[model samples]
Target: MKFGARNQITATVGTVKTGDVMSQIDLQVDHPHGMSSVMTTESLQELGIKPGDKVRVIVKAIHVLVAKE
Candidate 1:
């Protein structure tokens, strides 16, 4: 898949918090400060993301996205 976002970084999944409709995923990047991504639970499931998994963090504007691939 292709993304318009150019700011990408490799990060480890720190935490996965899922609710009924949405989910929040914490990321551990190289930087001292961490990051988080909020996506739908369905999308989270589709990615099969879990704590300690490696993922790509995509940043565009004020939004954060995660890709398991």
Candidate 2:
């Protein structure tokens, strides 16, 4: 999941923020944007992620093309 950034950066997962129940979990990414976005609890859970660990981030842009639809 490594993306277009240095592989030496690291971050820690802090407290979980939930709003109005069933909300997306807010994960604290230490290094911020120049590398990757902080992942949410739900996102992490979906990807089987955990705290106190290093994870790779793969970034990509999705585009949709239309032809007189």
Candidate 3:
């Protein structure tokens, strides 16, 4: 598949939390940090995401905010 986003990362599924309308996916990336994504339950079912499955995380955004204390 082709995407306009340039930021993509390969990660393994760490957890799957499903709600009535949405699902939260936790991923264990190669780096020390981890990533989380929230999508519709329908999309999650279509993708068949499960623990231990390897997936790509694509990030496309207009702005990223940073703050320092």
Winning model by TM-score: 3
26 in model 2: Cα distance from truth in Å?
A: 7.1
Residue lDDT tens for model 2, 1-69? 546533333454444444343433334465463332445546656765544445444333332234694
Summarize candidate 3's per-residue lDDT along 1-69 as a digit string, tens digits: 888886887899999999999999999998889889999999999999999999988887654456899
TM-scores for all candidates? 0.80, 0.30, 0.86
Ranking by TM-score: 3, 1, 2
Q: State candidate 1's TM-score.
A: 0.80
lDDT of 3 at 5: 83
What is candidate 1's lDDT per residue for 6-25, written digit by digit as tens?
Answer: 68889999989999999999
Error of 3 at 65 (Å): 2.4
Clashing pairs in 3: none
